[model samples]
Target: MNHISLYAQSLVYIVAGLNHFLNPRTYLAIMPPYIPAHQFMVTISGIAEIILGIGLLFRATQSVSAWGLIFLLIAIFPANVYMATSAKFIKFPAWLRWLRLPLQAVLIWWAYRYT
Candidate 1:
């Protein structure tokens, strides 16, 4: 059961990382204007996700990978805030947008579980 959960977590990050490259505009759209180099940041995050996800596959690296994800999630939280608060993102339902804020906490906790 532990292994299954670990693998599932890994899959989630791997796919999410891939999505950054495959659909960068989605991430870019939500980025706060205050953040510089949207494209570079997205690419770096994607690569980090891929590397950390792979790291979780090994016992020696699982804890470290989990810590990295926790930090990554925290680092990108401003984008989530931007999506929720910016008038430009009004197309999304307000409730759903607001909900993403708490979802970040869930994701942080999820990563912490592996630590």
Candidate 2:
């Protein structure tokens, strides 16, 4: 990945990870029904994002971090689907919820580039 893309990816993950703690309710509101322990899952994923984001900055860890992020994206994909399919559960507009589905794919592809 180019420097700009790498930096952007890192920032995205870092900021998002921080947001999980700063605004856990937003994330909790979207947690799929099938997923257990919503709060724990959110916190764990937040930590993962922070670690992966920092890992991406180093040459030694970039590839592994990218793969880790790709796996993380895939793992969390069900939440995206749930959000898109169950718009009534959340306050977000239908368009925005639907938009997130494709954005998840883009994020996966972005992370894959580094692998």
Candidate 3:
């Protein structure tokens, strides 16, 4: 079960990272107004996700990779807040938007398990 979950989480991060490059507009849209260089941030985040996800597969790097993921999730948290609160994202249901905030915590907890 541990191995299964580790692989699953790694895959999730890898695909999500890829999605940043494949659908950059979506990521850009949710970036907080205070953040600078939306495109660059998206690109860097994608690269980090890909690297960390791959690192999780190696026994030597698994714990460090999990720590990286925790920080990454924390770093992007403002975007989740922006999505929930901004009028620009009003098309999404209010409940769903708000749900993203707590979901980040869940993601952080999941990453911690690997650490």
TM-score list, all predictions: 0.96, 0.94, 0.98
Candidate number that wins on TM-score, 1 or 3: 3
Candidate 1, after superposition: displacement of residue 17 in Å? 0.5
TM-score of 1: 0.96
Worst-scoring 10-residue span by lDDT in model 1: 2-11
Residue pairs clashing in model 1 are none
For candidate 1, write residues 1-115 as lDDT tens digits. Answer: 9889889889999999999999999999988999999999999999999999998999899999999999999999999999999999888999999999999999889889889
lDDT of 1 at 80: 91
Q: After the best TM-score superposition of candidate 2, give how far the Cα of residue 75 lies from its true spot, in angstroms.
A: 0.9
Q: Which ranges in model 2 have alpha carbons more than 4 Å from their true place?
A: none
Order of models, best TM-score first: 3, 1, 2
Whole-model Cα lDDT per candidate?
0.93, 0.91, 0.95
Tell me the spans in candidate 1 whose CA falls farther than 4 Å from its real position: none
- Decoy 2 TM-score against native: 0.94
Candidate order, lDDT descending: 3, 1, 2
Q: Candidate 3 overall Cα lDDT vs. reference?
A: 0.95
- lDDT for 17 (candidate 2): 94
Q: In TM-score terms, which candidate is top?
A: 3
Q: Whose lDDT is higher: candidate 1's or candidate 3's?
A: 3
Residue range 45-82, candidate 2, lDDT tens digits: 99999999999999999999999999999889899888
